[model samples]
Target: MLEVKVKAGVPIPLDVSFQVAAGEVLALVGASGSGKSTLLRTIAGLYQPSEARVAVNGAVWLDTGAGINLPTRRRRLGMVFQSYGLFPHMTAAGNVMAALEYLPKPERAAEAARLLALVNLGDMERRRPAELSGGQQQRVAVARALARRPEVLLLDEPFSAVDRSTREKLYQEIRNLRRVLNMPVVLVTHDMSEAQMLADRMVVIDCGRMLASGSAAEVMIDPAALRGVGLREAGSVLNARIVAHEEDGLTRLDTSAGSLLLPRIEGAAGAAVRVRIMAHEVILSRDAPQGLSALNILPVTVLALRQGDGPGMLVELQAGEETILARITQRSALAMGLQAGDACHAILKTMAVAQDNVGVMQPVI
Candidate 1:
């Protein structure tokens, strides 16, 4: 587990505290220049704050009260930056081998090969950073980070440099890697959707202050956290299991709310997955509407209602044991007399959920 508590007055004020368990991915989410990267730097010992306590699995890396501070090289943590920081002159295998100085020279080559293959880059071991694609270079970086055998892994917007198609593939690769990496992984990202898809839990930060911390589902449902992740991007994440691929090109998923149909998902049936339901895409109805083209209608009970200064309202609903959110006009909410404990149905179009909004559920390590 990784425990962090940092407070500073100068150089970007930050007062954040959070914990991440082993085999868990905790995302630090906020807008650009929101001190997300600063926190990561502090944890990696790249930067020191006025006062802080950074520990990994009971080992103290930094303790202001104790006047103990470790340098970056002394910290047993691997970090992957947005830029694939690779030696252009070195091959992928060589880049990974550079971090294996502690091993016998003869054994380094074999270990590098093993790490490259771990990230599905065995064939590209000989390719230099200049010759490899962006995703491949990122893979090389990941291989090198893992080579350290670090106790914690720090990912700083690792996917932002890749294209959307490549980003999705990397996301899956990270999901696959988490199964074997038995350490806490911290990810810093401004993209809420990415955090929702990849992180087991999230720490919402804004203006150098921590707003909220919890599972992606829990943070997204909080109004305070929504402020950190712009209200425009607010949504709920539901855990589901892929049941089957329908003949009509949709995939059926079994959630607590009931079966949900979405555009064909990539994984095989029985795979656990997360479905992101955008609040703005949902339509609330007091009565089940007939003659609708949409096939997904979930009977839900209004859990709570939050209205902002704007003309819109955020409605929280309980569908079975799952919590869903809907963003509707305050006028519409009033017209329907929506309130806590009121029974209603949530209408969602089959196409509303895009492929990017779906992610493989990370197993609890």
Candidate 2:
């Protein structure tokens, strides 16, 4: 368990707190200098907190009421800085071994090799950080943090140095590591896509205060919170597959609702992707348009219909197991007879869905 409520000498007080069950990843997501790093530092004993407390798996690391402030070393925590902080002189194996000094030299070496293997870097254990790519070094840093097997792991933008392709691989590695060692991880990142994909639950923070904390679905799809962050109220994210790509710069996608067409895509045929269709992009229809330019005509059943935080109503639609959002004005909703559990044709132009609306839609870019 971890908790904190601290201020960084700012006009708006920064106060946020959350706990991670062992092996689960809880992400801190917000803008730069939102004091996300400060929150992590406070929990790690890097800074003295004016208020609040820090604990790990039932042990109290910081207690304001008891006036206890343990040194960082005394706290049982594993830290992976944004820079990774790998030693240039040390090989990947050597860096991991340093964290396990309590063990014999032979055991330390074995442990290093084991941790490296856990992260799928068994082949590069002997190579120094300088010899490895940015992604490789970050993996080494993660292995090093686990050599001693601390109760908690703190990662601050650990994948910034890596590209999207490699980052997915690292995500899998982290998932594997969590399975092998049941330690809670605190991941700090600014990218919502990364945060949504990597974290089990997301904690939204701004000005050092917590805005929302819930599963990725609950935290991100809320138009109010997104509006607060200036994110346009796009509809829900739909899981899609690149069934086919056209030579004319359009691609056919197989979504839960039905087959749809979108702008030229770069994904391999038969690859899974996320398509973001904002509610505003979808145009409703009482009857299908016979000769319309709108490419996607999804036959959807409205799961829930309610007012949106902003100007439009939030219509949650179900095509299959997947859900999507359609934002429409109150007048349109009433005129179209849009009601909960109503079946309707959700119409949209193929080109209306922008790249941002497509979650992790790859290869086309």
Candidate 3:
């Protein structure tokens, strides 16, 4: 586990504390210059805090009160930055071999080759950074980082430099690597979809303060939390399993709320997936409508009602073990008699489910 507690410093003038368990990915998400990268640097021992305590497992990396601050090299951490940061003069194999200099001279070559193969870059080991594509260079960087066999891994917007297709492929690679490494991973990203896809837990920071921290599903569904960080469009996330693919260009998903039919998804049957439901896309009705073009409708009980800053209102609903949110005008909410404990039906159009809002669920080990 990784524990961090910082009072205030040159990085960010705010108090923050959090713990990340082994094999879990904790994402730091916020606008640019929100101190997300600063926190990661602090944890990696690249930055000194005014007062802080950082630890991993039973080892203490920084204790300002005790005058103990380990250097970056002594922290045993693997970090992949936005830039690949490869040596222009060296081949991919050479770059990874540099990280294994502590090994015996005879063992370095074989170990470097093994690490390259682990990252699926064995065939490209002899290629230099200039010859490799953006994705390949990032893969080489990852291989070099893992060559050290560090205790934790830090990724700072590692995929932002790649194209959409390349980013998607890299996402799958990171998911697979997580299963093999099973170490704590901390990622910094501004893309909410990326955070939803890769992070087990997410921390929203803004103005040098942590606004919210929880499971991605929990944090995304909470309007107050999202608004605290200045995200206006509130949404909810649901875990579902792809049950079948209809011949009529629709896919069937089974969630705790019920069966949901949406536009065809890219995953095969039996694959676990996460779906994001935007609050503004949902329509609540006191009575179930019989004739509607909407393909998805679920019975839900109102959990709470929150007034927004404008004329809108947020209605929280509970369907089975899952919670969903709907945004409606205050006048419409009053007309529908929306109140806590009232039962209603949530209507959503199939087309509103965007491709980016769906992602394969990462297995928890």
Return the number of clashes found in candidate 2.
9
Q: Using lDDT, give the best candidate's number.
A: 1
lDDT for residue 7 in candidate 3, whole number 0-100: 77
**lDDT pick, better of 1 and 2:** 1
| Candidates in descending TM-score order | 1, 3, 2
Report every candidate's CA lDDT: 0.91, 0.76, 0.85
Candidate 3's residue-wise lDDT over 243-327, tens digit each? 9999999999999999999898877788888888888899998899999999899999999998877888878899878888888
Which segments of candidate 2 are over 4 A away from where they belong? 1-12, 175-178, 233-298, 303-313, 328-337, 346-365
Q: lDDT (0-100) at residue 182 of candidate 2?
A: 79
Residue-wise lDDT of candidate 1 within 258-282, one digit each (tens)?
Answer: 8999999888788888888999999
Model 2 agreement with the true structure over 225-250: per-residue lDDT tens digits? 56534455334567788888887889
Q: Which is superior by TM-score, 2 or 3?
A: 3
Residue 93 deviation, candidate 1, in Å? 0.7
* Weakest ten-residue segment in model 1 by summed lDDT: 356-365
Best-fitting candidate, measured by TM-score? 1
Ranking by lDDT: 1, 3, 2
